[model samples]
Target: MPVDAPMPGSYGVRIPPWLAAEQATLPARITDRTERMRMVNRIAARNVEEGTGGPFAALVLDSDTGDVVSAGVNLVLSANVASAHAEVVALSLAQTRVGDWNLGTDPARPRALVGNAQPCVMCLGTLIWSGVKALDFSVPGFEVERITGFDEGPVPADWREQLEKRGIAVDTGLLQEECSTVLEDFRSRVAAGTITLYNGG
Candidate 1:
């Protein structure tokens, strides 16, 4: 059991390596952004099938080496920890595995992160310091509220500009509607009372 951080009080959340190993091998060895996003959707779809609720999922990887550093899915329902968003889980494992927060210029791996949705407020906040190199995501933050009825809170209107300003290459709309379908699935199931949200409510 590894906590995401060594800070006091909250002690962060548990990061089991088994989960990391299971998701480490991404769907393929392709470098195209859209293909990468479709792979992320696969992880998300599995979450739905396994009854993990709104299992938003993410993968942390190294661009230069094309290695899946780690992968994460929402664990709030299973772990009873509200901090277990997919981006955070993936980012946390990534930071630990790389042994440093800043990894872009590293002599090896040259890390990055990819996710199925625009980062929620908390995950967006974590990225500036997570220090992978590039940020790639599938959906727009606005659609998160519109299509899924999930209120993504307080994302600074200029958040992307801010990340770019920090030298973090941020790419959005990777798979566009394809990625949205996963959210739509969750939304439909939630409406039917077949799926529940640990945090999305």
Candidate 2:
């Protein structure tokens, strides 16, 4: 006989209190791409400092008006869920706010997902299925693995081209230095035994 299904609230992710407070105080619109990325980097660094999760954060924004649709940080360690990566949380939150799963259904008003670092293989799949039109990120997956000692999985060699082929604009190297700094700090903390590096078996 098949086992009973798990309870509805047994597993779920949540935006940590610090991140929620910051999200509430964001401006109505950002307008500048650099500024948008800067915010993401800051959030990533703060996530490490707060010991909520890994040094990663993401935002879903209205590509046209620069309105922040939703913000999310990696909640894997905090929520005890493996799939709580920043990209997944951000995209899921965006879908919830708009009352639809397809974020790019309207071509005119597309949404963009911005992150402090490149998505791992799992998150890459989530980004494609989430219907976001554009992806902007800083720090390459290889560099992230090198700095933080987390397995990013086998991201495709031509991941950018694949996204482009699917009509998703890929913008890399946004605030690279600043983003790398956050990852480096996380590494330092992990070395000091102050942060837990959660990697799959």
Candidate 3:
């Protein structure tokens, strides 16, 4: 038998062309912190009950205006590809909308990222490369591994320190109980063998 099978079909993320235009016209900032956090959390929660990618969601926001530019959920298992991660999808869409891919730069008003769980290494690297100055997450990485039974890969003990060094500010522990519930649901599904986390075995 062949060692590997061909990918069944195309899998990726794409936002409509009009989205970028829409984002450009958004008001230049949101003053309400609670409103902004709630928006991110609500979107994150939506994907948990019924959406793509396990139980994670992510968003890219305009740091100055607090307007949401792009958002998506983890699509690895659903898309049968590793790049379909929530952060990957969201960042890509945000860049696509802006067309510069440098939205994360600009010391005056860099972009911001929010995710339901701490980003995996691939996403972390993307965040650094993408130039986002601020990151907010609801769940810690260790908790994901402890509760979900999947190896989180080689994230250093000083992950936060590394980000801080790069001028990326991180906020943790928002909506803890709600985010953990999503993690619990993911573990339950994995335990029942309802989904194979990945194809490589």
Candidate 4:
């Protein structure tokens, strides 16, 4: 496995686990702060019913063999995920982003810049929902720098500044720079040698 790649069966959390739980159960009936939360939960529920696990994962069709390369959640179990709306958003994001293919429709095509950007929101929401015990977004890897507001520092300095600037009191512990799991896909690519290694030790 590439040293920089995430370990097998690990997924990082970009947000708080409890907060994600909150987002998972957003009130569908009330029209207020929980609207987005409700949407996320709905998506999760549908993912379970449909038997399409990895609501946070995306499929990448290998241009060479038409094989599917999955990144993010391995399977989006409906039981694990409890919202239909959230499933829509997550699946949509995965289809549109992640993996070697950049085009949402064609997984074989590789558009590193745009395609890589697709997993941001889903990843964030998943980590929250999964109760990610740890996480690490710092360090430049796999187009990580291209993310506008992400950083490798101990704290999400950029996210903090933006929230504070907007007068939003950021109270989530998930924001702190802590090491955590990154799902099994990260290791699968390495064992398969799909992800290339560069730079120096």
Which candidate should be chosen as best, given lDDT against the real structure? 2
Error of 4 at 73 (Å): 7.9
Worst 10 residues of 4 by lDDT: 174-183
lDDT of 4: 0.29
Give per-residue CA lDDT, model 4, range 8-70, as digits (tens).
694322322433454345332332222222233333233223334322222222323333222
Report the lDDT tens digits of candidate 2 across residue range 42-143: 998889989999999999998889999999999899998999999999999999999999999999999999999999999999999999999999999989
TM-score of 1: 0.83
Task: Rank all candidate structures by their lDDT, best first, as comma-separated numbers.
Answer: 2, 1, 3, 4
- Span of ten consecutive residues with least summed lDDT in model 1: 15-24
Candidate 2 deviant stretches above 4 angstroms: 1-10
Those runs of model 3 whose alpha carbons end farther than 4 Å from true positions after fitting are 1-11, 14-31, 199-201
List per-prediction Cα lDDT, in the order shown: 0.74, 0.91, 0.70, 0.29
Q: lDDT for model 2, please.
A: 0.91
Query: Taking the tens digit of each residue's C-alpha lDDT, what string does model 3 give over 22-138?
Result: 345534555455555555566555554453456667778877678777766666765566777778878888888789777755677778888878887778888888878888888
- The C-alpha RMSD of each candidate to the native structure, in angstroms, is 5.1, 2.8, 4.6, 16.9
The TM-score measured for candidate 3 stands at: 0.79
Ten contiguous residues with the weakest lDDT in model 2: 2-11
Error of 3 at 47 (Å): 2.7
Q: Write out the backbone clash pairs for model 3.
A: 28-65, 29-65, 30-65, 53-74, 104-131
